[model samples]
Target: MNKQDYDIIVMGGGLAGCSSAIQLRSQGQRVLLLEQQRYPVHKLCGEFLSVEVISSFARLGILEAVRKAGAHPITRTYLTTSNGASLESELPGVGLGLSRYQLDLLLFQRAQELGADCLDGTKVNSVSGGLQQGFMVNTSQGNFSSRLVLGCHGKRSTLDLSRPFTGQYNPFVAFKGHYTGIALPGVIELHAFPGGYCGLSQIETGEINLCWIAHEKILNCKNSTLPDPLWQNPVLAARLHSMQCVRKSQHRLSQISFALKGKFDADVCMIGDSAGMITPFCGDGMAMALQSAEMAIPLVTGFLQGNLSERDLKRQYTSIWNREFRTRLQIGRLLHASFINAGIANLGVSLCDTFPALARGFIQATRGRDHGANLATSDI
Candidate 1:
């Protein structure tokens, strides 16, 4: 019997990769995590983590670390449309406000503490293989072999080589920045404007996370930056009157497709943004990334343990992945599609308020059992 370099190789050490590393190491598996960026780097995200991470990472100690880091506790929501039609609702569960800069670093360190081999500043050029040939991963440093490879490479990566495996239609572009001198009412907020929606929440550092998503038309092609439409909507503008954007924290990503992504792409098991993006306006995409990690590691464990064949492992994982996320992704697309029309958006909220079941269904379907417990709008 020969030994592979690692039992598993996880590409891209964001939420999915790092969380997968932490869990697999916890289960006594040999895991290798390859990440391109150094720790503490900012990534474009709403930065509002679902409280669901509490029960999921309960044994991992990541939750406690988040709380200790001063992650704001949120139990309510405030939403405003492009027309400034505002409404408030109580959250069924608690949420945490912490930037990816903090969250990713914490998870990366936790994986290291648990003895998982993590390679930072290493970029994976490509991944190829199967049960018969085993898995071969080529990185900037060198090539390595593993029994299984999990692609957590985010929304776009070199692995989407050749033409592109994921959807590449008219996609949304997202922008994020940290701002000082702005305060919130300890609730999660989403403000809508033409072509985009912004999420506002306070993080551990006492700064507001001004993250928004807009149509690709808003991207500045020459500089790869998003124009300052942060104040285009009067409601959004009012919020920023006293706040100053943190130049260092500005981050943006273009071509954010809402098209349904596959469970597996290019022979690599895709998770997180690599798998598919959730609704920028309606759901907790961050938590969905963390949840993807939980879903894959267990099945991968079975394959490495020889309890399941490679074929069975992939089949079961796909089945489970579809079961857990399909409905949520579908709901997100519907929400995104409807949000395009302000009239429908306003009416949808009204219907949700008038018919509590619609709101509850939308929340449960998109947020899962973990959140949307008391949501008051959007399904209709």
Candidate 2:
């Protein structure tokens, strides 16, 4: 038998890619991780972790490391509508506030320490071959072969255009920045405006992460920056006025789509946003990234060991992926759609205020089951 270059080659070294590399390596599989950018970088994200991920972090052995890096614990949520109506509720569980810059670096180092071959600053130009034939990955660093490949390159990549699962063009744009002088250490806030919403939370560095997403039309109407109506809400306005923007930490992205994404294509398993991006309002994208990595490990392991056929592996992974995240993404889309309408937005806030249980239920529904126990017991 001809030996392949690696047991697995994971493209895109963000949370999904890094975590997958670590998990696979822990199981004694030789893995290679390709990342186009260097470590400790910022990405456009809400930068909030849901409580559902605590167990996964503990299982991944990064709980302590994350805490040491200054992750702030959050237990409450505050939401406001464009009309200035507000609703507050206690979170079902404790969440964490940490920047991707810190989180990604820590995970990457852990993967390297565990013996996963990591190639930072390397971009994968193309991927070919199939499950039976193995895969030929052409990258800026060099070409390589692997029995299995995982795509975690995230939203809107050049690879997406080349793959069969290219989603429709979405006009949504997102902006994120770190700021100081806004206080609300234990609470996560989401303020809704016309065609957009903003999330503010305290990350480990003591700076507030202010991220907002909106339709391009709404932003274009408002001087092409902060939406004008966002300041109409007193709470959000005050926070915005008080924030001292961190120039170096600002990031932006355009053409974000919330459409359902294809899970498997060209014999590559998609994880994180590469698979499907949950609407940011749910604040579960980071957790979903970690969870998807956990979901991929067992299936990939079974396939590489010959206990599962390529067809079976893809089928089972797609089933598991749909089962785990489909509903949450659906809920996210519904909520996002509703919020885009001013009347529904205000009415929803009023209802949540009148019935706090409903608010709690909405939060619960958005967060899926905790699979930490399964991770703990799994050899991979």
- Highest lDDT among the candidates is held by which one? 2
lDDT for 344 in candidate 2 is 91
RMSD of 1: 4.0
Q: RMSD, model 2, all Cα superposed?
A: 3.5
Ten contiguous residues with the weakest lDDT in model 1: 371-380
How many residue pairs clash in each candidate at the backbone level? 0, 0
Q: What is the lDDT of residue 152 in candidate 2?
A: 92
The 10 consecutive residues of candidate 2 with the worst lDDT sum are 371-380
**What lDDT, from 0 to 1, does candidate 2 have?**
0.85
For model 1, residues 189-294, the per-residue Cα lDDT tens digits are 8876666678889888989998887776655445344345545556777887787878899987766766566767556778787887778766577778888888
Q: Clash pairs of candidate 1?
A: none
Q: Give the clashing pairs for model 2.
A: none
Best by TM-score: 2
